[model samples]
Target: MQQLAFYQSLWATERRRPGVPERPVSERFDAVKADGYHGMAIDLGAMTLEQARATVPEFARTGLGGLLTAFPQSVDDLRPAIRLAKDIGSPFLIVIGQVMPLSVAGMIPVIREWLALARAEGMPLQFETHRDCITNDLFATVQLLDAIPEMRMAADLSHYVVNREMLYPIRPEYRALISRVLARCDSFQGRVASRNQVQVPIGFPQHAKWVATFLDWWTEGLAGWRGRAGPDDTAIFMCELGPPEYALTDARGDELSDRRQEALQIRAMVEDRWKALGA
Candidate 1:
């Protein structure tokens, strides 16, 4: 059976309560495990290797495995992150780009370098579809894909939906683009988005259409993954509904809804959809 892993945005959690101190890794790990998540994805950009290493045992204690999301400033810096992933026995390293290359040709070398780094370390890495990085603009990623035929991506469509300010009921032309992305996508991320906002909670009336749109995208993306993958391969759809500021708010700065509850709801929805796909 394939497993679903939830990526924890520990930094976002900490940012929500500005005056309060951030929770310890142990606390975060316990909370996620209790919520019934099988695994975790930890973004280690803000921490030192030593600090990240120290936190690994906490994940193990909760019977929860984790993949590290490393922000590598240079190609060579990826090795340490891959080494850390190997130490934790993570199946893959999720790479989030920090630099934006000027041209698709420039981006090709960067992808090659990352692939080499992962291959040299005997680990696997997938570039995340995110904004403000090498794949910042959706069109640029399409261009990069043309240059490198075998590149794999972890699809976080929320970014692209927001990046392009995608209109609802998705235009027919845009649907074709989305289909192309689904075909090549190796993994998925969960978060409802509108053209203007990336992380809206799933229940509010105003957000209903957006929520429905994301679920449809998730369905399409999941089916695509299943078609390409064998029965033994796990498909990871990370429910990364981050805390406030990533989670939207009103003028007063209060959250749109309870994010913890929203995440659990999203998890339930994903499970139901996965079951239907199998049937």
Candidate 2:
């Protein structure tokens, strides 16, 4: 049977509030495990490979899985992360390639190199569709997908929505492009965004439309994944509600909403979507 595994972003645990002290790593892992999360995501964007490796024993101690989100600034940058991911028993690594080439043609060789590296390491790698990354532009990403048929992606549609400044009742062209993306996506991330904002409170009444849009997309994506996945394969959906600037805050720098609750809600929503697909 196809299974669904939910992960919490370790980076999202940062409470950058003025007076609040950050929780210890063990406590954070305990909290995630207590909340029924299957794993915790370690972001290499903010931590070194050595730093990421330190958390491996903690994950083992907590009996929870670990996932690596790598920010590879160059082709060679991914090798160490891949080795670390394999050493730590991570199911896969998500790459947000910071090595931007000038054109789609220029990007081809870079992507091919990384994919080859992942294969050689015997680790699964998925390029994330994110802003400020190689897959930054929506149109360009579509073109790249066409150019590299073997490329797979981790869908974070929040970036594309903001990248295109998508309007209400999404345009046909944009919807088609997004459909193409969904078709190739092997995993997905949870975050709601409007045309102008990267992360929005899904439960807020003002953000209802954007919330609905994301849920619908997720449902479609999950259904498509189910159709293609093997019987014993599992689909991973990460609840990555970010911290500080990625999260909206008030005058006092306190977050406008409770991210932990929002992340749980997103997890529940995805679980429901997975269940809706039947056994």
Best by lDDT: 2
What is the C-alpha local distance difference test score of candidate 2? 0.89
- TM-score of predicted structure 2: 0.97
The superposed Cα distance between candidate 2 and the true structure at residue 156, in angstroms, equals: 0.8
* Residue 41's lDDT in candidate 2: 89
TM-scores of the candidates are: 0.93, 0.97
lDDT of each: 0.78, 0.89
| Cα lDDT of model 1 by residue, 76-142, tens digit | 8887888889777678887888766898888889988888878878887778888878888778888
